[model samples]
Target chain A: MTTIFGVPITALYGQLVVGLVNGCFYAMLSLGLSIIFGMLDIVNFAHGAFYMLGAVLTWFAFTQFGISYWWALLLVPLVLAAAGAIIERSLLRRLYRLDPIYGLLFTFGLALVLEGLLRYKYGVSGLPYSIPDNLQGVFNLGFMFLPKYRAWVVIAALLVSLTTWLIIEKTSLGAYLRAATENPALVGAFGINVPAMTTITYAVGVALAGLAGVLAAPATQISPLMGSNLIIVVFAVVVIGGMGSILGSIVTGLGLGLIEGLTKVFYPQASSTMVFFIMAIVLLVRPAGLFGRER
Target chain B: MPNIVKYGGYSLLLLAGILAPLVIYPVFLMKALCFALFACAFNLLLGYTGLLSFGHAAFFGTAGYIAGYLIKQSSFGPGLGILSGTLAAGALGLVVGNLVIRRQGIYFSMITLALAQLIYFLYLQASFTGGEDGLQAIPRGRLFWFINLENDLTLYYVVLAIFLGGTLLVYRTIHSPFGQVLKAIRENEARAISLGYDVNRYKLMAFVLSATLSGLAGATKALVFTFVTLTDAHWHTSGDVVLMSLLGGMGSVSGPIVGAFSIVTLENELSDKVGSFVTVIIGAIFMVCVLVFRSGIVGEVSTLYRRVVGQREQ
Candidate 1:
């Protein structure tokens, strides 16, 4: 019965919850992108494609092999991580010495190829993905009902993001990564296998996207076209957050997701463009991004 | 290439353009010309200026929509409609260029891309764009006061003229002293800055110029196709431009034209037989071009020609 800004409180809460769920996916994807950019100095334009691959491959396993969603949640990332390793080792490794923009162009092609192959086989119609039985119910949150699956997604995504953050910021491997990001030549001189490190870092970064895709499968219809648009919004999220800091990307992704939710509540028209509009404002005020240090 | 070879090639191409409509489908040629001009506009930024914009379609598509709307709804003639579209695109370029030029290199590409998506969303949601159905049945009305464009042949010439004009403009811009500054900035931004050139201003100018020409191409395409759709503004079209420029040869004057024609022909040939596989083919071509053919058709041929000549002289 209560109203805020002439909208029902329940509707507002529902949108916020939806936004938070979306934010989780953004956090995971952007975190991966930030990590990849930091270590490899290459923007993985195909991050979205890899994420879609995770979901598609998961769905493929489910339909063909009777593999459960629980298994997919663990298996999909590994499969894609291996795929990422191959891609990095074969295609991306050659372009490291060239301008970084070549990396973007190369991945953009990879995305087109991946999305096109899937579209050719499956057609453009949405493929159904059901939530696991245990995660089907809704939880009473006093003011509004929250879907159990969504809550789980939020928790799992947050946990994964935290683990990634800790790994990059706290561990000895993280130390090596940070060092390599700063000066690859110096780190290579220290007897660390930098090329191997580069390959593994790319694989892990892609695995994060795969994990997010698996989490997203039950919530949304699986489609070849799903990742293309979502990736652009994530790009905007990366720009606003600035790829310099790991936590910065996470917080920005979540924060932008919430803002998007609020916009949908207040004015649905601006919801799609709110993130980009905010990006323009952020670019104007701080060209280096909120968390990015000026080079 | 030597001046004799260059001028001879241009003359031959002009002759082909003048005579080809008789042999080939005017509609298809017009489409290719429009895309060729669009790629040339894209090349101005990416090739000459060393700024890769993933959002050039914002200008191309927006101009198409505007030109389509004006000629269809407002009864504006094609000339005025296209002119208005080009100017409007220039205005948009100024605004977007101002914001995106803040970042250099890869970030520039990302920001342009994100802003373009914003524009795409705007077109998708706006009523004027007709949402999903797109602005359809756009008449290719009379040019100035007379010239009937209802005939395919008449319209083909107009589109060709526009394509040539746009391309010449790009060529002139590239050879100008201003273009040299752009190349310098591309090679070394800090050095260009230290030399007392206002680097941002130069970049902004090139961006706006590229956006304006892209709009000109889009506007012509709208007239040629007799409709404007969301596909024109989509990021895929932006990617297509990048591919065209890259495949033909980035930073080369004739490269985008060759690239555009080849891609257009390939798509035309394959779209019927393979359906969605066209995307895969294009993507594969992109990968091949990036990996091994970085210099592109023109760049590689020129290099080879020079190498053989040098050997002969030695």
Candidate 2:
């Protein structure tokens, strides 16, 4: 009933929720990308493909095997983590010594392979995945009616992001990861299995994408293209955030998502380009990103 | 590296361009030539300057759309339409290059890609782009008010001339003093800076030139096909040009031409047979190229030739 700048309060809140949910996904994906970049020194361009695989696997688990969304949320990440580990050990390891750009190129090819295979199998159509029965209804939050599934996505993403941040910042393993990222040779000299750590780091990063994919499956259309499309936006988020710190990516991602939501309220046409517009401005003002230290 | 080998290679390419249209499908050859020029343009930045732009398609596709709009709506002559398109792309290059030159390596690639996607989104939303359906039924239109491009044969020679002209420009640029400075920056940026060369200025120059030439190819392709679509601007087109440059041999003059022709022919053959799996195959080729053939076809051949000659001398 209330109006904010000519747009209904309900509409504004609704778009904000949508933006927040989208931001959560961006946070998770960029967090994974940043972590992988820190450890492996590669951008892991296949991250989007892995995310798509997460969603696709969720769809497959549900329709073919009668696996519920609950089970998928548990299993998809594990499966993708395994796949990530294998890809790192076999394909990515050879690329560490080359220019970091080659890593981006190689993973891009990997993404194409994944997206192409799925497209060939499923066609370009978006296969529907319904929200579970428990999370189907909406919560009347006084001002706006919020879908239960979307609320769950936001909460779950925050939990995952916070847990990841804690693990890297507070835990001893996180210390090793930070150390390895800084100087792998010194870490290796300390008798740590640096290569294995790199592999695990990639796997964990990929698992984060998988988790994001699963979170996104019910909220959006499940399609082969879902990841590639989203990943570019996340890249803008990463650029804006500067991949400097875990908190930076998480904060930037959510913040950009909110900005995008506000844009939708005033100028829906620019919603898509809003993040990019911000990215250009950020690059001009602080090329190191909002939270990133200049390397 | 010898002048005789270089001149002989150009002569051979010219002869083939003249004779091949008669033997193969002219339209297909025209497509390959356009792409060859595009790849050559891309190679100028990647090979000589060590800048990997993942958004060259922004220039290519934007130019195509602009050329199509001007020729179709404004009724501009084809030559003027293309020139306008090329200049527009150069201007875009100037703006984008200025923003991205501060970043290096993967950051550079990512920024270029993101900016290109921004352009892509704008085109998708713009009324002139025709959104998903793309700009269609563009006229082939005559050049110089007399030379008709409606005929496929007449157009093939014209396309060949344009391709050669673009390639020649790239060749000249690569061998010029400016190009040497680009190579210096590529090899060692810090060293180049120490040597008193303004590295960013040289990079910006290369980016604009690369973008303009890529625009030339895309604008010509619109006329040859008489249609301009969003596919021209898609990131996939950017990746395709990268693949062509990588597969051909990035630094060599003949590499991109060879790479473009090979990829175009391969895509043409595979699209009909594999249908939906063409992307997978292209991706597979990309992975293989990066993993096993980083030196590329030309680079490998040259290395092998040098090795054999050294062995004989020994």
Candidate 3:
């Protein structure tokens, strides 16, 4: 009940919780982005659109077939992972030798296509996604009351983010990925099926995006345009974190989300522009980004 | 000579553009020219300079707002309003370009896009821009304070002149020593730096020129439509310009023009029929161009012409 710096502690903490909730999304999305950029040397511009698809498809599965949230959680990522693999093997693989910017452009086109098709079918409205019965209530944390679903989202996203990081950092497959990232041809010479790995890596990155989408659907609007809107901010987060470090992406994403939340509490008007402004300052001072190593 | 044929081809297209207003809709032609200028300015960066600026809509839309505000607020003539808008965008370019010139390739692109989004958010909040409604019904005014822009023909001629001037300016810049250095930096940045050229400065110059020209196009479009909307500032517009240059051919003189006209014409003719899928169609074209047809329509035609001519000579 105490006031901290003119704002009530509960109010401040509530905003921080909201910020961290959004940051969970930012962390997950940017982690996928860093993985894709690190290994493929291509910035996946379509990441957001795919994220949107996960949300939209979740809504579709439920409304059309009465599928529940648990089912969506289990089913959506697999479907998206398959779609990601197809997109990679069929199209993205061809762009590997071109300038990395083309991958950004080509994926941009793909995002447009997917979003456009969805928009054409569904219009621009946000379909309702009711929270599951188990996560429908609030948790009393004494000073600040947290919604159970929101807290679940945070925990799930953090777990997923850390697990992906661990898989890349600790596992043998992760070692191969690290090796291939450093030298794809050398890894290929070791008979590790580098091409298949590239496709799978891309699929994994997008599957992470899909998972984030599912986590986000109940909290935010499950709309076609949601992905494009969030993707820009995620891009800034990736830049701020630097594309070199996976852990950097997670930390920066979460921290920036909190900063953005703090900005919302202090100066509501600057919340949108704050991340981009930070990006400019970072580029000005550390052109490679705060966590990024020079290429 | 082949030079005469190429010049002849260009002249023929310009003449068609000038004469077509007599038969086709003047408004649509004006729209095409505005987009053509925008695409050409965009092409100047990507095609000739080898820098992909993914945030050009910031320049285009910001200029539109500036020109709209000036002409609507005061008695500023069309020329001065557009000039001021373009200068403002160029100044913005200097700031943005200075920040981004240090980064190369995709980093440069993401920085530009992020910075443009910041500008978009700024405009969205600022009072003078009229927010979501944008600055509507902006006065086109007179050229030189007396020549009436009310007449559609007069406005068409004015628009044509600006488009031609912009194209010529880009052409001259491309052929200049400055442009050569910009291309050198694009082709190989480390080598250009080793060869004693200040690469970042050259890049900044190119970026400013591109921004100014794009601003000019945006200001003109504002006058032609008498309205400036948030659509201009959106990232999608930036993507559209990239698509134009990509589909038209990057470095070639007429590629963006051909590319812009193709897209504008397609949108004009097909939007009603295709509905929202129009974006998907455009995106598909972008993917095809990037994946397979990196050289674009004009690029392919010229290459084919060369092969045919070479075979005939043999």
Candidate 4:
């Protein structure tokens, strides 16, 4: 039995694994938030609700139509993308030209309404989306018994986040998005359909949250409230990462998740507030966030 | 409204307020009055200062807990408890406002919200709050070392007096030179700064003032209800006040009072019948208010009144 810093090493490794798993979800959610904020200039307060919808609708598909986890993973994001499109077309489209606070307020209302409706249909006692038979085994990673499902979750989340980062930062379409973010009017002047582009960008951003939801279903209990509490923490992440950078969100989220995990290992009570404690400190030190560029 | 109509309307409203306890349930009115005070305090920042402090319920609910605990443990008059709660809230505002005012616009809202949730988590975990059971059966105590507050009617008038005092304080602040500076900062911060105002200090002061008043409301509510709970400090309460201020009309003195009364009545009406549907209903109301009723009930009525007055002049 090996020990590090006079503490059991296996326990440390286990907490680190859990932290990485938590980090995956945080990274995915904050990634979506950063994308929407960068392109559409709206905070997407309903991002958490959309994440909950992903879990709920995926669970819905499973129970109603016997859709497997694999299929629902593909289907849920598309379904939520359509919903996002509709929301953008109906409500959010009117808000882009106004004060951004109006956008924040609009999404806040949408979140409460959506969560309330879900709770109305399915009582607060969360439904379970169990691990598939294939993903149930464990891997003895030398130090700890790592669950196979959790590894898949981390891989899948990282892949999704990486692909999103590449699509927005590397490809030609990515160039347009980056350009669009800087000056929409200028981008529009170049024969680009900025409105349609803005709408699609928002949908994609929401789809990323939906993808995160599907990934999180087996990790946590599938509940209508899955997103509400998590969203505030994500908001703190967005604040700490600043709204200016995409990579900032992904990196900060993962880092904080690890920090929070370490706090759990040392002092369980402070685990809940550790990220926020970091958030306050970060704001005091760098008002624009770690990777934020002063605009 | 003309001077005659304005003064007459105010007199009539006060008269109705004085008589409301006779007609309406005193407990219900006390509830409304407390919420009305909370909303108005919230309005002072949002309506007048143009800083949307989303964490106000932290002050409102924390004060309730403090006041309730003091009244339960000590033999001090309720006035002392309320005062201490209010000052403590002001101190909290000073700290929170320090962190939050560093960011502007949407970030300001998010910071306030995050900090409020931090407080909520603290209250949730702290033993002093009594957790799920809450601080129950708090004493109303003597209002001024003389008047007994155990009686329902006495408590109602006490709440009313506090409500009036809080409203008048906000009213005067809105009309004062400091308020003018705050309003100038709200309308255009850069312009206000260019004109040589220490905008941060003004904003922080308004935030503290709003918080202290909200604490006053919460303290009164605890004494009135004879208990305090986490619900007082919850984000939902913060959202409710935002809804009230917006629905009644932001940037107006009387808007939050109307908004608070209507929402409390609406909650009273709907909670029994629909239960869970109340959230959905409130959300829908929020959507509708933001979408079309940006001016709010009182704001629109005043606009109409002004239009009619202009027509008469023409």
Candidate 5:
């Protein structure tokens, strides 16, 4: 095997794959955060909780009903979306008129409640979800061995993020969302049912997090504490990518993942913080973020 | 008559704090006082400047590490070590605050958290921090040439002086014209800018001041505990300080100290009773405080007192 930058090709490729997989989660989660922030002006701090909820729920579905991974891929989002909708209507809706800080505080509370409930039910230890029979094996690419499940996760997350971007940016529904985000009153005046649209938008965003969680279940440990750790990193991704641009978030997520992977290969010590280190640099050069427009 | 009584009541409270450690466990009281100072420093940003920095643990924890390292590894005494730690934290705050203050509201919070996490990672990797074990078993050392901090009584008085000094500094800042400018900026930045005040400068100053003071508290804490760990610098520590300020009363001078004491006491008691659910409880409190008591405990009490006095006069 050849060496790149004094590291084995396999080692480099493996870290890159890991980075891509992590990036996919970042993109999906950050996409959700950006979309919700765009329309609601509320930073949904409970998003990680929702993602954790997805993983836990998937585990439950499998254990209780013998539901397979294929079924979970479809079912988890619907369940999480329904939960998200209910939460929006019941608690989140009330804080729309207040400072955006209130939304953050409320969602933070929601996160604690959700995580606490999960921890209560299933202790801090993680539960394992088996790789599906079809994607259980590894494929050897000349230089590296690739896990089929991880590749699938990256492809699936890419598809989800691209589809979300298309629906919000290219389609008529996307047009309506853009209008609603920009001028809710005007959109409502035009008979767009802005409130319902807002509710749906939030649900869809959260459902994205759920879908990511499902994908992550097999790759990482399915634990209640997983989301809290990941969300802060995702927030940095959002900051670096700029919440204003959809494509920016996707590209930044993937790019940052690659950078992190490279760091792991060359300097394992900095791998954990490679994304944030880049974020600091980005902030210094472009205070509004690379894609964020000056407000 | 009532105004004089209120003033007298505050003085009595201060007197009690000075005298309490004589009777109670000085170590616990010292811990509380250090945390109180930390909370007040945090309040300077969130309460006065309206910037909710979620990464103050960087200052608090990093300073503790620096102070600990200096006393244990170097020739410097405790005072010099603490000053160096505070300056280090202040320098870090300046760099971070410059970057974060560009964004407003939730974005600011995220930026601070991310930057703090970066510092955490740096510390984790740095040789001096000792990673997971952290820098432990630091010498408390004497304050000057005479006072041995190894004695609980001597340490308690030292901590008391620091806390009192910190509290008075915060008080002076709150009453200063500079503080009024910060309040103005917090209430309405555009208006303050229109009024010819350089809002960003005021904010950065406040941020640096808060970071320095938080570092001072952390440095003192390291001396008191004779150890410094990664837990102090973690994002959760930042969140804990936020909870302290919010619980105490954001804008009130004594509110953060009260908030810090209550929260520390509550956590100690509750964690003893129900080990794992403390976070859930704290989170619940955060939600409740944000929704129902935005002005916080001190703010609410003061308002109620004023109202009751008005009723009596009527």
Candidate 6:
């Protein structure tokens, strides 16, 4: 029954939870984008399309094969990664030698094709996916009620992001990936198959998007257009976080998400554009981004 | 000898374009001309300056709204309204360009897009834009004192004049020393900076010039159609312009014009038959253009022409 800053405390807390949930998705997707941009110097504009693909693919699996969310959590990323590898090998490989702008254009085209095809088959309307039975209940957390599904999403996403960070920063494979990103030709001369590594890196980045998409299906509407909206925001997050650092993207994404949530509770009109407002301010102050090193 | 013949061929093609509206519907031709100008203006930055802005819709659509509002609310004629609208867009570009020009490559594109979206949200909330319905029922108004733009023919000639003026201006800019410096920066910024050129200033000038021309086109378009809507200001409009520029060929002067006309004509003819499939076809064309026709229609033709001339000379 307490009020904080002229609004009900419970309502404020509820929005904060929603904000955190949204942030989790932003962190995951922007982290993937940062990794891809850092390594390839190519902005993967079709990242949203891949995310949409993940949701649609999950829906298809559920309807046809009765695959539950548990199985989807395992299978979706692998499928998306395989698709990403094929796209890189077949289409993206040709663009590596050209200007980075061409990579953006090519991916933009790919996104349109993917979204259009999905719209053609499924229409613009979304399909509903239920949360698994085990996570159907809600918990009273003293301050506010929390949905079990949302809590699960936050924990799972954090774990996934942490694991990705550890693998890339700590492991030998991660070392090799980092080294290849810095100097592909030198890495290749040292007996690393740099081209194959590049392909796999793109796949891993795309797989992260797919994984996020699968997590999102139960929380949000499973629609083709969903990814398009989120992708633009994620781009802002990536810019704010600096495209070179994975941890920067994660922290920025989550932080911005909470800020947006707070705005919704305090001032509803600015909520939609709060993230962009911050982005503009960040751009003016530090063109290289908060966490990015200047080129 | 062959060079003269090629010049003659190009002149004839220009003559054909000028005379086409007489045979075809003038309204449709006017729409195509507006879009052609818009695409050309966009190409000035992307092709010549090597800055790919993803928020051009902000200028185009905002100008449309401003022009629409003036014609609807004030007694100002279409000419003054369009001029004011263009100035508004140019001023906006100056501010936005200053902020965004500091970043290069993908970051620049992202900044433009996000800023444009912010403008879009502003328009959505502002009472002057009429919210969702937009500024509707805008008057065509008279051009100067005598010419009535209510007639389709009068509007067509007015649009033609604007398009011609814009094209010539762009051509002059391209041939200017400033444009040469821009190209140098585009090819290699480090080299240009080392050569003591202020690359940021050149980029900002180009951005403002492109935005002004695009705004002129959009303002004229609002007068011609007598309507301004939120659709014009959306990110999709920005994407459409980019697609047109890319489809035509980035570096060539006449490419975007050709691309704009062809795309508008194709969409008009096919939309009734295919419905939403137009998006798919456009996307396919984008893919095909990026993958197979990197040089674009005009670029390819010029290359072929040069090759043929060389063979003949030999």
Worst 10 residues of 1 chain B by lDDT: B138-147
Candidate 4, superposed: residue stretches over 4 Å from native: A4-7
How does the DockQ of candidate 1 come out?
Answer: 0.87
Best by DockQ: 2
Q: What interface RMSD does each of the candidate structures achieve?
A: 0.7, 0.6, 0.9, 0.8, 1.5, 1.1
Which sections of candidate 3 miss by over 4 Å? none
Q: Write down the C-alpha DockQ for each prediction.
A: 0.87, 0.89, 0.86, 0.78, 0.68, 0.73
Pairs in clash, predicted candidate 5: none
lDDT of 4 by residue, B243-309 (tens): 9998999868889999999999999999999888788888888888878888899999989988998
lDDT of 2 by residue, A19-80 (tens): 99999999999999999999998997889888899998999999999999999999999999
Ranking by DockQ: 2, 1, 3, 4, 6, 5
- Pairs clashing within candidate 2: none
RMSD of candidate 2 to the true fold?
1.1
- Enumerate residue pairs that collide in model 4: B47-B251
RMSD of each: 1.0, 1.1, 1.1, 1.2, 1.7, 1.5
* TM-score head-to-head 1 vs 5, winner: 1
Per-residue lDDT over B221-269 for candidate 3, one digit per residue giving the tens place of the 0 to 100 score: 9999999999999999999999999999886878999899999999998
Q: What's the lDDT for residue B149 in model 1?
A: 96
Per residue, candidate 1 scores C-alpha lDDT tens digits across A53-170 of: 8889888999999999999999999999999999999989999999998899999999999999999999988888899999999999887899999999999999999998998889
* Clash count list over all predictions: 0, 0, 0, 1, 0, 0
lDDT string for model 6 (B119-202, tens) is 888899889999899888998877878998899987888898899999889989999999899899889999999999988989
